[model samples]
Target: MLPFTYALRNLFRDPARLLQTVGGAALVVLLLIAAVALNEGMNSVLENSGSTKNVILMGKGSEESIERSEVPLSAESAVATSVRGLQEVLGVSAVSGEIFYQAPLHIAQGKESQALLRGVLENALLVHRSVQLIDGRFPQSGEVMVGHLAHRKLGVAEEDLAVGESLYFGDTELKIAGRFIAPGTVLESEVWFDRNDLAVLTQRDSLSSVTVRMDAAEFEDVEVFTLQRNDLELAAISEQGYYDKLSTFYEPIKVMTWVTAALVAAGALFGGLNTLYAAFAARIREMATLQSIGFTRKALFVSLIQESLLATLTGTLVAFILGYFILDGLAVPFSIGTFTLTLTPSVIGVGLITGVLLGTIGTLPPAIRCLAPSLPSALRSS
Candidate 1:
């Protein structure tokens, strides 16, 4: 068997080749980390954004998008009185009629871009239990409260959406009354408006949906109500179910992300393979010499694998360091909201496994070919 020091010593024999191997592995591993983290971040946000105990009541045939749904303004009152076993706080039912809108909103003396808007009453907090008012007061008439991460979605500076600033919706100017956060959810990227104010500004006479929080009520109760209330023409769905469907809807985005990363990594992988082939081809005579010295072919092969592993593992370390600094806690904005990227245990595991596979499987072709020639022929050849 080759001594551990033998493989270590051989790694530095060609500084240029060592650099190429390490750099290629680093680039490939980093790309994998980014791709996996991105998908995880997106899925986490969408999955955590909704709750199984909550049910959304939207207009018939509008289950896919609340923004397009239109329910009568009286639906909120009807659900509260009709639905049994609803959650309540101090006798106030946990029911909220809300309007969801997306439109171009202008900052005070800044750019205009599309922003997600949610119109709700104070009781909205009852249904969206994750919401926490971190600053100032909730929005009243002529006022709005921005989500803590809303600026990221709007592509504006953080200070632009701070409390005391103002946002413009057409000719209407709404004061930024506060900042709130709903961690791990899409709500953190929306701007909340007073229910009345939003209806007036958007010229909406109807609501997008009514959200109800259940305590002892089963989903069947809600579905039964929808069926009984034929005149209302409502659709009942669990909040968690809605988000799960949204995850399925975004499946293509995840696929595209992986495809793009694979394409870029493929280029780097091929370059690394070519480099390894040349480096190993040059060492054929050395491998043959070791085999002739009573060392088994398997032992030489193991040493070559050790060298490759060392370089790839070093690159993997580099990738983890970079990912921690750059991707961890990074906020990524999408159509619905923002999600933070973290180097979670799953992501790190994937990266480490990828590094190991690249070291072993990626080295096989060149390693096998390098040892293929007989000891006599290898010794005679260059």
Candidate 2:
């Protein structure tokens, strides 16, 4: 076994070369961490949106998107009456009919943005517990309730959100009466309005979806009855399942992560190999001295590999510290979702393993080259 100080000293012998190798490995680890964090962040967004006790009913032909589904208003009433095991809080049973629309909104700040519009009845807040009032008042007939992210992006403050302040969307101008927050869900990026007002404005009389709450223990019976109705053609699914299906919308992202990782690794591997070869090139006399002292070829090779591994481990530690603080809390927006990068335990593990493997694999060929010659031959060349 080599002393820890020996490996440490060997790496720092050529400060420039050591830094290059470490920096290359560090950059690869950083890219890997960032990629995995995105997937985890997206998963968190969807998982938080899902509730085990809630069920979503959409038109039969629609696979995942509520925006594409159009359920007749009469179906909501029929499902409510026939569905057994429906949970009720207070006197009202836990069922709500809702509509979804997307439109280009002209910000009062002189910027044009497209936002998803969700039209809800009075019990929306009660059914979705995450919805909380942060300011002003609830929506009146012609008013809108803005989400936190919407407020931030649209530059609409609570003071600016008065009962009669008009916002132009296409040919319509809706008033802003309140602001709400629903944490850890895509709802935070939407604007809520009265269903009747939205339907009139959008020229759609039908609802988009219906949500019902039932006892988790009785989910089996409720699911069977809800889907087996002879007159209604609809699909009923757990809210969790519905959100999980939404992952398909971002499927390209997972593939993109792997592709980026592979590219970074290829670059890192080449850079690491070059640095290790340069380090060995400079230490030709040192290898000759080791051979003269009866240190076997295998020992010399192992020492070089260990030296490379030490340098990479240092970089990985630095990257972990930097990535957790600098990369986390970064919010990136897209048409379908907004994600904040996060480094979970699994992500960190992957980064570390990648760095170490790059170090070991990059050093092997150079280490073998350094050990192949006779002591007199290597010494005579320098």
For 1-382, candidate 2 gives per-residue lDDT tens digits of 4455777787777788878887888888888888888788888888898888888888887847899998888877776777766776786777789999888777565666677888998767656878898877778777898876774444445344444566776767778887777887877778888889888888898899888877543567656765677455677788888888877767787788779887976788787787677778777778888777777777777777788888888889878988978888776555654656777789899989977887687777888787677788888867
Candidate 1 residue pairs in backbone clash: none
Worst lDDT run of 10 residues, candidate 2, spans 152-161
Clashes of 2: 0
Global Cα lDDT for candidate 2: 0.77
Provide the TM-score for each candidate, comma-separated: 0.99, 0.88
Off by over 4 Å in 2: 1-3, 151-166, 216-231
Q: What is the C-alpha local distance difference test score of each model?
A: 0.94, 0.77
**lDDT per residue, candidate 1, 267-348, as tens digits?**
9999999999999999999999999989998999999999999999999999999999999999999898999998999999
